[model samples]
Target chain A: MLYIHHSICISPQFTFPEVNLEELVRSTDHKLYAKLIVNPDIPPAMLRRMGKAVKLAVSASGPLLKQYQNLEGIIVGTANGGMEDCIKFLNQIIQYEEGVLTPTNFVQSTPNAIAAQIGFLSKNKGYNITHVHRGLAFENALLDAFMQLDDNPGHTYLVAGIDEISDYNFNIEYLCGYIKKEPVDNVHLYESNTHGSIAGEGVAAFVVNNNQKGAFSCVKALKMLHSTDKDEVEQAFKQFLSENLSDNKTVDLLLSGENGDSRYLDYYRLMEAAVPGAAIGRYKHLSGEYQTSSAFAVWLADYVLRQQQIPELIVKQHSGGNTIRNIVLYTNYQGLQHSFILLSKS
Target chain B: MKVFVTGMGIITSIGDSVESNRKALMEGCCGIGMLKGFSTRYAETLLFGEVKFTNEELRNMAGVNERGVSRTSLLALHAFKQAVSSASLSHEVISDSKTALIVGNTVGGMCLTDELYKDANQRDTGSEYVASYDCGSVGIFLQQKFGMKGIINTINTACSSSANAIMYGTRLIRKGYAKRVIVGGTDSLAKFTINGFNSLHILSSAHCSPFDANRSGLNLGEGAAFLVLESEEVRDNKKVLAEVKGYANTNDAYHPSTLSDTGDGPLLAMTKALEQAGLAPADIDFVNTHGTATENNDEVESRAMISLFNNKVPAFASTKSNVGHTLGASGAVEAVYCILNLLHQEVYPSLNFNAPIAGTGLIPVREYSKAPLDHIMSNSFGFGGNCSSLIFSRV
Candidate 1:
């Protein structure tokens, strides 16, 4: 019932809105920073006060919100929200020795600030929420929207996953071995047995509803898991696929987030073995890795299904089939956080 | 499908357990005073609803030996264990795939903003707390503790965070994704929030007076509360504290941090919740309100109540007057308090209130008294115009 009528993303890959998708650019700065996309409608004063994450989220979802007025709700997901503004406020507190300070940065520092700003912009005023969990944040938010759609038929929702890279989060993640020790060629992401990934910023948004008119793709199922045990995961994966697929057959494509982390290669191998006949595709190499990188994979699923062809750059091991229909995107983080999403060509 | 509250646990500035909090409520004792648990520049200048437990002590209470986790997680664990034990839920039952955990929190490990600041600026390997900096750390910490396999997520919509968590929990059960859910929220008083609220100029130097004509602002507090809610089919002959009758979440969409002057969001939330419960304003016996005592909140909430009840506003009180506005934890915490009202057929008085606000002229219950109650409403409105209301009725 969850159909994507319109979708767009702002990432290191490109700003794909009303415009066409662009070729991927590999990460060279150890971090793939999103190219800041600006909207002319946003007042310059408001833009001046917005933090990096707020700006990215508004720029990505604002157009959709403006085009389609009075959407029922807005659900946003983020791992580290407004770390840039938060750090600014913290630095001020330290610099001023707990003296008088401005509230703008602190007001915009909460994880829900992105959704709040969007709420102010759209003024729809129905139901609004933000999910701040790490790996499953987007899935949770999407499920909330789907739950609403199921409750009230034919309701439109704006769902998004956003994360902005800042010096604070990037440096800490780099030191913690989640990011590559040094800048590596993202083009050769999986070629070497490296221990870490190249981090990136991403905001993927969709205008979704149950009406299905002019819809490009549909998300049939979503399952989140916390266990890393192979048997448990395999069993869950089998159950997820069997329950979601009408034909109970192999999916057309499996766009996985195997972000070239050598430590979790075995987990990816286990995943590939679970689905034998599916065409394997990879996206983290193009978009870089993040907490909600699976969002980008979902966005790509809609595109591949609409175009009925897989982009060769993203194809790791392509099947001979030319027509793409069912896509199952699997995303894993440190082998601890994992999710499976079943998306179908409309 | 009826969602029944099977068990509850709470740790607030007033008390640590259900019985203790109930006793404090009966005595009309307030939990807000000078800050003690966490130190800040406003420590002596402003009042807070501190939980009266140090991090090390809370760790001991929670039976946690981990250091990387924040105080927020420890408070959550303290309440979570109590809820599980009170419900007599075994480890096997809790770890079942049908049992879900949906928690709401605001200041996760950021309560340790100082430590995070140090770790982020480091040149060498990051501290162990790097992974725990985000809001997910609290839920992830409790998830690992129980080995919970069901849908686990953290919600953060500012002050109404946990009320939305409870509402979402009901949706999951209705959708058949879960049979039972442990839903609640936890927030620790931290320099991060204190400074944040202080910067907003909403932190009251004196005690907050809900519904008072000369009310100032809110006192930032710290606490945690949780409810173990189960579908009726899973009742299995368990004692039901109350039935979750109705709930609604709405946004004013007028501003980021302030509710509109007309109480548009509050009115919608309360009206919709009553509609879902299939009740009228007259059916509500009492209301645990989200009266933050700020100039905007008190007047707006009062106006909303007057409009919804047709000027015969039900007996209402803000628990924030007892425990300073707990922010993210207030929704779930006040929910536990409302369940208390339902169970005992009594109402708690607002701690600090005198005359009603000038325009609205709404007066809160000033004395803890026994009342025949059927349905009790709890309201939680947060920053970002996120407002939610939940109703609990006699089973």
Candidate 2:
């Protein structure tokens, strides 16, 4: 029952500086990369110390945090924490005989270094936990915050998720066949018949608490499944909806993790069919794919809850947004580890 | 929501199992010695509190046939197996339903990274080296070996990794996420960590004497420990060793390498943990301080303890002097030390403390003392200004 007091996202999509996302999507000039962050100043010393992901996470956390006085806990999630730093460290260590290795890069290569940095920058001396569970990384941290709020009320938790893609990342995904070969319009990602989704990077943060501050919807329930099939995923979705809703009715919005990957299309397709009356929306096209992209879906949910409007480009059916009281977000990594986070207007 | 510790296992330089570790602590035996586990290029100046077992011995005890397991994972598996055995949990039970494993290793498989590096570059490198360097492989191997389905997470928050893991385990039980969980951390000495600490000029040549006025720095050690936490519903004949009364994590958010000069983060974390445990600082009988013997760490931590206790601190000691600073495993390792203290009713000495600090006027207990200790507090602070404190009480 934690409330989302403030939230921010720095992704490839059009998210920052604009209150409405539809406007950003319309103003996009290119389609290859989609980082949503606005223009930011990068200090020279920071550039020497931080990679793109760390920079993005630190910036987002800094702005979104309002009550820095008694910041109770910090929970960070990343599919690959500091892979770029790790690559730099590894290449340097192997290239040079430990003589020219930069301790700065090597020190910040650990996954929790970003959280540590956030702690330092914010002067937050509260509980800090870092999670790296592939796709469920962000969801796990979010759930941890939810549980923390439930057990100890009136405390604010900083929940952040970040992941970045480098040439090494593209190489690994290229080897794993997760990168797209053919050019596809992100605006029309669902129309594609291809299997792989485009790779992207971003960081998102939320100041959440048990008390509903009315700026965002309250998260009703969250569930993570390992090795979920299409049928079982649909059944679980229905069970989740039933657990929350007294009326056997459709939700107002259904946010999805439909990356261009064909193996996982059936999961979203099942979701689309299950929620007949809801306005279905897919975001991986605008943001691309990372371990914690579901966090972007959360940002989207917050936006929809606040603005009470859905962009036509995002509307799959456009049937039930006049009374958009509920938004159910479904996210997973390659359809293996799935998460369901349900939120409603406060 | 009651979280009970049903079983505990450890593999430190002092011993290989919980019983042996307890006996050693009671007998006032120290395990810090000259480094012998791995060959070091900078050998003359380095000392460590290293376990005597080879990787093969740990792997054999852990029942892992795969050679891809890293030395850190080997230590983790060994301790995890011992925990299961100590708790009397059958393999069938673990394989049947959602048993989760929460491993907190700051440097996951750095030892493997060392091997991978030399094998690739040096022609004279040994042919026997074969292990994966990926950080997630440790958790993946444990999950595969044990056949667990519940939430498997790897926390990499430096020194507080395993303390956060135990905190997560308790939260999982209270949240009804899992009926049982194996929570702990493991770290092995590697060239990267050693060189990193050496570059920082914080590696002590001799055995570490934490909180000593003349202590220079800490001697790095390697080990692992895991505790089986059972939800109140599942506790059968398994006697509760101690209850995870409360825990809190706080970030200094001050500096990457240094804590705040005021020690506010550690103080806040300890206060929150005490509040969660429904106790005051006066209720804590003993504290397992994160006295890494480094000048900055000891002085700042002593200042924080004073602030928390309002000038009357509990009888606390730094066990790092005995086992060296185990890094990521230190928090969890010391936690087991706290539980051992609670059960044994005696406080271990801080070892090698001769004088008080110039400003804080704080002195740790120099020798073991017999006392009716019921509750113990343990602190672990890390590089990112991450500080965590846990309160464990005897059942």
Which numbered prediction scores highest in lDDT against the true structure?
1
What tens-digit string does per-residue lDDT give for candidate 2 at B170-272? Answer: 8898888888888898898876777677767788887777777788888888899999999888888779989999998888877777777898778888998
TM-score of each: 0.98, 0.88
Residues A70-152, candidate 2, lDDT per residue (tens digit)?
67778999867777776566666556655534577666777888787777666666677788766778988888888888877
lDDT of 1 by residue, B246-334 (tens): 99988988887889998889999999999989999999999999999999998999999999999999999988988898888889999
RMSD of each: 1.3, 4.2
lDDT of 2 at B392: 97
Whole-structure CA lDDT of model 1: 0.87
Chain B TM-scores across candidates: 0.98, 0.95
